[model samples]
Target: MSIYGYESLTGRTAVVTGAASGMGEATARRLAAHGVRVALLARRAERLDALAGKIAADGGQALAVTADVTDAASVRAAAERVRDAYGPADLVVNSAGVMLPNPVDAGRTDEWARMIDTNLGGALHVIDAFRADLLAAAAEGRPADLVNVSSIGAHVVFPNYAVYGATKAALTQLSASLRTEFGPRGVRVSNVEPGLTDTELGSHIDNAELSQALDGMFQAFGQALTADDIADLIAYTTSRPRHVNLRQLVVLPTVQA
Candidate 1:
């Protein structure tokens, strides 16, 4: 533990999904800076490799493992590689997600399905793959954390964002349930809800109108949160003592509300 009473995160192992870009990438970098061995997981191998290389050059331990979170087999294989590289993960961050919002009357079934599968199903896959490792870490009295990156859309209503909101809401509820099941078992479960952040999450939107509206919203906020901002909170949450659990966090830009 540090002099400030915060548990030292040095020498711990962490797994961060969606680590190729945005918040996942930033969180991976932050954790590595704290001396944690990080495993970068995402569908983009090149991005993961570059990030891993950057971490290595900075004198931190990192392993790049390409994975598709929607596929159980892929996540399982990636978990095996993580175990081989850095042993069981003491921290896991489920940050892989998609936000393709469109009006419910627009009948954009494809977008809705993608959001549900990637945002909700994908998180479950990572949890299923790493549950045993987390339990093991807790059994040894290490500070183990499972952080789920949901969005403020889970609690707030937005036009043309019904499906996206549904998936996030489900994720939030799931985190709450898991907290009850895992809290006493020693692993800390945290649900993080971030509001309007400047990330590539909006670049893939198929609906032009909604995309423009999102851009306008960000512009109006003037100072929007960045990936690094959320990373800081995540690092703080995971660095607490074994007995301390920061259950839920809602982070937003000062200008956002």
Candidate 2:
């Protein structure tokens, strides 16, 4: 995507979870390029620091924060750091998620729990941490936004994605509910559901059968969407006029039917 005419997005502070790589990393770079102050949050301190350094070198303001969104305490601490460096973040993106596929017969309860903890619980933790700031921004008549990164798995019932998809489904519903409650307050809540994006997200799969199936299915779709594509979509959603809210966006590859 070309440089965005982000007149409305410039000079805003944004906190992005999972900013170490993939969608989070892409989103951070895109926002920083558009002259927004971006805070990178993830468990990988070294990776976050590297990305932050790159952004700074490119003349963009950024903060690298080592945080685990699954843990409320960690998220809260990260929020404190962001507030100190960039003030309360008016823009927040929940992109920290795990999609470990485990079939019902596999009985991988651990993976299921992991998905719930990170995919759903993690989003909640971040939202709970920064929700007050969002509300405050809206109260101040400032533009505020919360973007949740979901997956097409939420809409389609894939064989092994049952557990992983469930968490994403919950996230989509949460975003919808938040928009309904917060829209009147001027806080735009949006859910971005991307289909078959090319990212490291596939590396977490533990199910061999499921992995092969997904691989073949994706191969059928000539070209998979890239992280930059989704990042652009997210930036566009957040850059819209405060009065305009793209509450739910389902972005899919043309061949992803």
Candidate 3:
């Protein structure tokens, strides 16, 4: 997936949550290459700082803001930091998410709650933190984008991943509603659902049986999508003309039936 002509992304400010690793990290690198000033938001300060340093070394601007998306106060504070450093973010990517697959009968209520907070609640906090900035950018005739990273689980029924899927489904719906409300105002809202991808996401599953099954499935498929693949899609979505909005994209590997 080679994309060209990202002239509009240059000199824009972008806030990317969960920027420490996986899809968020890949997206940050890809956007920085396109000349976007990126703010790296995540709980791991060390990792964020390292990534920021790498971006800086590559002649790109980046700010490492230690933040936990599940905490509204943390997200708010992070937003303020980004504003101070790079001004209002014209692009916001809600990519911080956790997938903990647990069976309903397993009584893993704690895992269920964690997934809800990080996957669903986290996106809300980010949107709330940067809502004004996105609107203001759009009002200024600048391109503003709100990209939410959902999942294929939102549409497919995965046995032990019910709670995780529910949260993603909710996020997908939320993105659609936001598009309706913000589209007229000029902010493009996109919901990106990715199929089987090789990332640390699967490591969060505590269910031993489920974990082995997923590992075997991925091994069989051989070349699952990479984090960079999703990043390319995001870069493409956000770089289109302001009048064009790729509202929903479901990216999947050919091997995944």
User: After aligning candidate 1 to the native by TM-score, how far in Å is the CA of 85 from where it should be?
Assistant: 0.8
Off by over 4 Å in 3: 1-4
Q: Where is model 1 poorest over a 10-residue stretch in terms of lDDT?
A: 1-10
Where model 1 places Cα greater than 4 Å from the true spot, the runs are 3-7
**lDDT tens digits, residue span 1-257, model 2:** 22345778889999999999999999999999989999999999999999999999999999999999889999999999999998999999999998898777889989988999999999999999999999999999888999999998887998777888999999999999888788888999999999999888888886677778778877888798999998999889998878788888999998877
Candidate order by decreasing lDDT: 3, 1, 2
lDDT of 1 by residue, 8-51 (tens): 78899999999999999999999999899999999999999999
TM-score list, all predictions: 0.98, 0.97, 0.98
**Worst window of 10 by summed lDDT in candidate 2:** 1-10
For candidate 2, the TM-score is 0.97
Stretches of candidate 2 off by over 4 Å are 1-4
- Using lDDT as the yardstick, the better of models 2 and 3 is 3
* Cα RMSD to the true fold for all candidates: 1.1, 2.1, 1.8
Query: What is the C-alpha lDDT profile of model 3 across 46-140, one tens digit per residue?
Result: 99999999999999999999999999999999999999998999999999999988788989889988989999999999999999999999999
